[model samples]
Target chain A: MNLRRTTTATALLAAALASVAAPGWSDTLRLQGYYDYVDLQLGLQLPTVVVPGEPTPFGLFAENAGPGTADYPVLLLSGGNNMQIEGVSGCTSLELPQRTCALAPLVANWAHVLRFRFHLEPFSRGIVVFGAALTSEAVDTNPGNELQVVSIPIVAEAETRVAFVDVVPETLVDGRLAWTVRVDNDGPSAAISPFVYNASWAYGGLVDVQCTSNGTASCPDQMNYLGPGSGWNIRLVAPPLSVDNPEIQVGYGVQPQEASNAFDNDGVWLVYRDAFFRDGFE
Target chain B: MAAVEGLMRGPRGLASFARAFGAACGGPLPALAAMLILQCHATTAPWSFVVMVVLALPAWWRDDGARLSLVDASALAIALAFAVSGLGPGWRFDGANAVPVAGFVALVLLARHARQGDAARVVALLAVVALLQLVPALVAYTRTGDPSLALRDAAVPWLVVPNDLAWMACAWPWWIALARERAGATRIAIVALLALQLVAFVLFGSRIAIAAAAVGTGYALLRDARGRWIGAGALGLAAAATFALGKGVASLEARMELWRAAWSLFVANPVFGLGAHGFVAGYREWMPAIPVDPRVTPWPHSLPLELLAQWGVVGFVAVALALVASWRSARGRRGRYALAPVAIAFALVACVEASAMRLWVWMFAALLLAWPRLDEGQEGTEAP
Candidate 1:
């Protein structure tokens, strides 16, 4: 009995030592399953600009939040077959052995989540459904969590044109100054993220905005999108500027890599609103 | 003078210092040549730094002593040439190059301090490191059916290959030293360890490295005359099999085109060649039969051809001389064996990898095969 115990222990030790000796072996032994199955969850990342007829980048991210390793029984991306996976090289004789073709295979864990980005094809403007799912052969604990769909409503536009619509003077800085500058986006398509406008004053300048606000009420510096003809009143607060010119340079052209006409994109204006310093009063 | 003194001080005065320093510390050369064979990358690699500080630096700081014959003057010259070229048009230099050069220098410094018992210690230390690396490799394998199959994890390009190969090389001297000492169980363990590393490396699909390892392994077994014949025959068989199996066809065709391109570059400036690191520029102008719509690569993939093309015969001779010098230094039983991995890796690197661009590749021949150390009851027979 003693010898048997000793022998067993020795073999175990040898096996353990052997396992430990290999580079990546020890990490495997800690896993609970014989082999894990992936439980995949998918989501979408909207691009900077989603025009109705123009090409734009849109990404779909899949996460496997499971202890199990996942191999694709099926990976489906709905945009029909014309949507080419952007960076994928040509398929070899079974680069992935599991399926005839898969978006990606062996999506083991969250670390190796499968992602696909495509030039979102031009379809009729409406809520465009970009849906993706990964059905793993591995035992998924939450089977319902497999499929994900992101339906982004693509707003229909007239002939594509966006420009600085209107900049209205709201308030004047009294003591430690405060005022509201209304910036509007007139567009066939919405102005995304960076709404860059130039504010130049003649005598005393307005610089250093306190904060930006929209929808609710707060000081506005940045904006999400300028829905066609709808504008956000961005209030500006400043300490003081050396170039104290009271004139505010209204709206500049849309700052894109390439634009059709720069002249139509930008418009200039002078502040008609009275400031305490311009009035030379309290 | 101070630089020379620093390299030598780790051993003794110039001559003995040269001998002791040049002799193999083993691991770094092959590792640099091949890259990491899937292992605990962070852990296995960091041990070198620890070994440097603990083992090498103290001895060097005290002006310790030893003996030698190897040098990489040609490598140095080529690197200098490349550095000059890298500085061309603009200072377009490879930043990560210093890593390999540093790895090379570290091997030299460590070998200078090596003793008889140090082999066992290094082997043991490296076994741990290799095992740690293997842990990641295995986990990776388990998750993804193929072992070598992983996303492109290049914090640095081809960084992992040489480091792993060096660590893998570390096991060799230990294997030899252990065998020489007749340390039975330990030898088995080391063998098992190496097998594991090789399996992981293969699954990683670094086909070039796999070939290099095979070459290195053949050299390892070729200690005696009988073993030599066996090794040679096996290598020939491997070559024959590679062709017979049709595996070599694609590689051969690719290499032929690369060699042609390289040839074109060489013919253009036969003497001085295209002023070191000028292969790509030359390729664009010369544009030999491009296979797979071949774009300009830094290396033509074949080491000898690349050398011939870029540095001309002069640069090529410098490398050949360096190898010869290293061989001369690490001659005899273990020295020969130790140099095997270095030689094979270089040969493999020549055929496949851009090892010349990575100065550390040269360091293998420079550092692993020979080094200077005190005659501390250790025979200078063993190789890195």
Candidate 2:
């Protein structure tokens, strides 16, 4: 009985010690940071107008005349800022350039289509602009004498930059696990497809990669491209018989081809991995 | 002299066999037989099959002429029906399989023995069982490094969380009764065992269990004082204070959510429920789009609500009726040893932390069989 008791005591002591000395007994601590850029684009659509008769109206008038009518006299004209005119005026009687005109006119009993072009800068991040115009040059303005003004709204958002530092202990085997990390997204524009990859020493074979768009996935098999802010887990299995010190490294960058780095093309980003050991069976 | 001795010994082997057969053939025989059949289908363990066959042999042999009351018969019938249903549904023959069968057997045994005025022995057996449960619980707590959290998790795998608490609550009164009736060494052992169980219960950090212990202890004390009205008033005040102080507000909130889910299930299928273990599937079907994390299990964490959601009004009403009957029988002891535990069990169940079906059946069985026989009662009065 005494021998049995001694053996039991020794076994229990060994078991306890073994638990304290187990590998991968530490908690992985993580510190993450990211930088990103964004670009905005806008387009405009125009409306069309029609006339009832070939009779040339007052103010601005465009007409289609036979080649023989090259010397037609100008009847009315009007001009404005940021406007250009271009079209084939077959009226040789009209004293005008071949395909260019500025606030020109047309002869009576002639019909033609008028085209106008306006150039406005419409892309801004933190600012907005709105404006309008009127068309008094056309007679009876097809439906009615109308004031046509273009109101364009432009907005610009400022870009952002972020950075942080973290410290994680290595005594989690017999203690509570805790860590603190700093995160920043200094923004003129939101980072598109931002992500952070974290790897740890105890389970050094597998890497946990997470993105803003997708959840965690194992790493090193094939890079899972989560479109603009996604992440996935990446698993890495080591050889059956191998021994190495458990360590951690982290690397992160924007997803390729997802976002334009127009705002902060020359920016650097950093991510960190820290861990501690704890002595407990979970 | 040898001839005379032989005559006196007379047919010992045959008598023993006859007695064993009579006990086996009692009303519990069919239920035991059904349990064995179900166990055969449920477990893959060769040893369990052997054990079941061995246990059932006595019941099978004695099943013919053993007398049983109507209540015992009905209880057996209900248990058999449930076992058959569970077998049909393909519930695995494992740890989960043993819960209802063990509960049924315990009830049958308790009721049989209690009605014969063997209450002391029954109570003693229960105390021993409660003490035994403490070993694994302690081991789990120590190994996990978080005693309370470990107890909570262990409760699930063991199916003993709230049930163990109820058993402990019940054991307290039995210990007290034993100590009062049989003093000296027996009383000391009982007291020590009860104290140990109480310590383990407290360390478990089961809010409902702790509350039940407090209530049971207070009721026992009040019973000894013969201050039933004072006890009632104190209990009311305590409940009021708990509610006013918001001590149980979080649990109450969780109860309300479960109640809502139960109500919705009842509204959709007023009969037969969605099916056993069907509350989650049903909830998913009718659950409104709420912006919150999803729950994995269908158990609303409230026993009554879970019952209503899974079994519909019929099963719920039957269970409620059974509880009422058991509570009524226990209350006849007039807030004595049995009454306090019953009250504590009811309180825990009302808190929506534990199911009372198993405990209620067991308590009822004990009440029916263990109450003092009229002759014993008279003898006791004469002795005093």
Candidate 3:
């Protein structure tokens, strides 16, 4: 009787110690109901606003929140309009609209990250809604978490509409002849790396070249760029008011190589004589 | 004798004084701190956390000589779970379960020795806080002429998510119960406070909160003969309000996406959750493909989902056990009558909002478990 009691007590103590020592094992022992549930969760990260026809990169962040390991976890990426899969990383299949990644065996409390690159066809405007779903060997108790759906707004290609807006003559503090050459960016987007290149010129080169804009009192970085509905003014001191070269002809055009409305992109301004001439005796 | 007396006059005396002060203040402090936290939008201040630690200290000073009840055990388990989950790689003591765990501990200490009067004082204070919150809210409403905008503007320099204030106000039923026990001026005052809370609720315009309040208050009041009509009216009004605000289908969709993200987090670590504020960091990895702003909804929005996502299955079990224990402890006729509304209100709010990690919310839950029976005779007496 004494021996039996001792054995019983010793066994109970060992079991209790084991339960306390290994939490995972104890959890499994206590709740066998969820032993087979493989909760594979799939998520995707991509830029919400993307330029069409450009190679855009996105990533798949996958996790197996499981009490059970997922031996065959597959990621299904699809439901995107006008999206073409240019390249993929960590995925097995290259199928359009519905690409599958047969991930490695994902045990409980483990994660797998995969990346992909795709391009949206040009002229694809409005919103594009895409979805990704996860499937594994074991059952996901909550299907709501296993799938992710996201929307991206496709923005049209940025058009830099750079055009010359009338030049005005002004007298400087030193009584020097100056012309304010105004340029307007009547754009629906921003002017990237915009510049007033001297396409053609005559007589002496421009002196005291200072730039200003409506956005700021002075141009930011030599008028490197202009926002939509903004104006940039390049103030040039009139060349030395000489009789030998009576007219200062300045020709310039704004660039992006191409403009949505290129008609007024370049303008030629002829300052006959000088501000002294324009004042009365032209 | 001289040496002992000298020692008493020194640091030891100060220590004793502090302990006495902490013990004396512990019962009302949780309620007071919760009130301030709920009313004030800024929680980054260290005062609330300091109060929690001070309140919890007295539990270690003198033995209350009371055996640990199932409710007490479960509550302690919750704190332990929170603390344990906070451990591991890059574990910092700040920003996760620190305050909540301290809150749970202090709640346990408060419960061990709190009397009916203490409970009453806490409830009364909470009601007063609710009334005070109404003033600014009303002023904003008068200016904005829109309840939602009013609530938002009133909480200037401090962002008040509509759901947060609405969740806090879910305790209106408890205030109503307290008012029923009063007479004349006190009763009228409590009634007036409830009215203000109702107005504040309307101004806040959180559909989830409105629905939770309606369910909790309606259930509590509909049982009484005098309050039956009022309860029915309230239920009708709440239903109508929810329906009217049902145009927020986008909000609901956003919540669904948030829930999905939380679910993904849970699946990633099913047994031991990501630990306190883990979802805040991890959800980015599992963000839904939708063009949803993560900053707008930092929390999972669902308490159960958050628990699963952050604390994992272990934390979830601890909470489940605590709920069972609370139900058992408050199953008596009078206890049920007193505790049911608060419990129901909080539970309903928890279903749709991240109320679990909030210190005030935990304090309210503690109040639910610690509240004394109304028939225990006058205010200040300890339960036999």
Candidate 4:
């Protein structure tokens, strides 16, 4: 028994040495998953003006209330609202000739939030986040009343949060290969309805979308659209999934806008808000 | 006369003093010169610095105690020609990256001395220097497992063909020479080490290196034959086998791809091809868009193709003339020295695998020209 024990120890030592000598063999490996959150802001400003026969440079118009006297109402235009004539006052009835007058305000302010979501794969290295903010300028404002111009600063930020998970491989009795991947979104925000798709050799072959989100009956269907807010336990099958041979890609975004297809093999994508324009509505 | 006298007298007068001074400082001059030129142009200076440092020890060791040989003189002339031609109209000095040319000059001078038996000390010094590179390389490999592979990926990021090929071509000759010099237990040990390196090369999966080794070894083995009929018959059989199985070889397939690309470049600019460093920029104009790593530029990759793209047929002819001249001048065991040009020529042809063709070709040409004349009576003293 002692001899056998010695032999086993020697064999283990030799294996360790062999692994060290050979290239690309390692022990005590760690696979990490991460989630990145990004915040972005967009805004705009316009110049103020008044109307004469048209709108004036400062939105200040002169009107005779009574016999050569005039009055102007102080108007504050703010936040995405269009300019309009308020009212005329402060004139005697006999001093000035009767005149029809109006006051038009310039400049408007508007703000909206655009959210983009993405998931980090296990064991991936050096992932990067890229995005842009888009906006449009308004043309043809109210005559005599110019818009106040405000410089809109575009804001962008990215933060990476990492977590580790256990991967268990399984062989199905029906000659299929499958694996249950436990992906934890270590970030403050839950990964939300995350589903693994477009699996490749890098990610250990084809992975079919399996049941997720608390194992409910609707989990598989709903998990296809992920990122509501929770870690995902997904099971995937292979072979048939290898036809398109698509690369492994995970995507997420805010309400209304769904994540687009993975940009490329590197799993990169860009997101931004659509442009806004003013019609005739007040 | 005064200047010459001063040179002979001032701290430089003593042979030992001059030798020590040169040892201490002369080795870095080429790199320093390169750095200055690079700095003047406002290009990246670090690459030039690294390349210069890499070339310095080899250059110094080669030139230390040696005299200029015919081969060295000819190489120097060629390098000078390139440098001069580079200064011509349409060639912007700022971007030409003249350090490689400068390094070529240093190597030529070193080769001349090596031919004269004056470079023994330099060779010894260089052996130490080359050995030092093994430290970091080995450490990196130990940490990451494959240093060269990692470096190649980090540096180039996209194509793997040329980097692997150039490394194999550069090291194979040295390995063969080292193997030839060893005996018994030591020989076995050396061979084992060489095998490990070769295995590493294979792991790089470079088709170019594998093919170059096969062709180079075949040429070496076929240099001499007992009878014309037997030799002819053997050649015919070999040719048939090669034709039948060449495509099965991955290296050959890669070479064919490179050749096709090169041929296209030649056809497009049959005249004075693209400008220096122009091939990478021009690849998009000629080739279809392939998903390429953002880090790697589209370089022609083959030496001949690079020449054809950059210098046109004229530059190619100049290179050919230089190679032929060196080949004709080499004497003694012509077969062995012949390997120098053949290796270089094959490497040039295989440029799609590496960017060292110009450097290797010039180095081989210098060695060829500086090869000690058999009549010089120093033949017996030549170190392996």
Residues B133-190, candidate 3: write the lDDT tens digits: 5677678888988764665556521223456556445777766777777788988998
Write model 3 residue lDDT over A1-282, tens digit each, in one string.
Answer: 343223223322332333234423312211122213456677678887765556778898778776457767777777476777643666655455456667777887788888887666654546667777876732222121377888887664544333334454566676456666666655444455565575434365555555654545446346555555666676656555554445665555566332332323445445455533444455
TM-scores of chain B alone in all candidate structures, in the order given: 0.65, 0.64, 0.78, 0.60
Best by DockQ: 3
CAPRI quality of model 1: incorrect
Clashes of each: 65, 67, 6, 50
Ranking by lDDT: 3, 1, 2, 4
Residue A23 displacement in candidate 4 (angstroms): 35
Tens-digit lDDT string for candidate 4 (B119-174): 22222232333333233334445566664434322222111222432333343443
| lDDT tens digits by residue: candidate 2, A1-282 | 343223223322332232233211110000000000000011123322111111112222333221112122322212233222232342233222222233223322344343333222212122122222211122111101112334332221223322223343323353322222222333322333334323332333443222222243333234432221222332222211122323433322222222323333322233333343444623
Q: What C-alpha root-mean-square deviation, in Å, does candidate 3 show against the real structure?
A: 19.6
What are the models' TM-scores? 0.45, 0.43, 0.51, 0.41
* Location of the lowest summed lDDT over 10 successive residues in candidate 3 chain A: A26-35
Model 1, position A279: C-alpha lDDT score: 50
Error of 2 at A67 (Å): 93
**Best candidate according to lDDT:** 3
> Model 4, residue B93: displacement in angstroms?
5.1
lDDT of residue A210 for candidate 2: 26
All models, DockQ values?
0.01, 0.01, 0.02, 0.01
User: How is the predicted docking of candidate 3 categorized under the CAPRI scheme?
Assistant: incorrect
lDDT of each: 0.45, 0.37, 0.58, 0.36
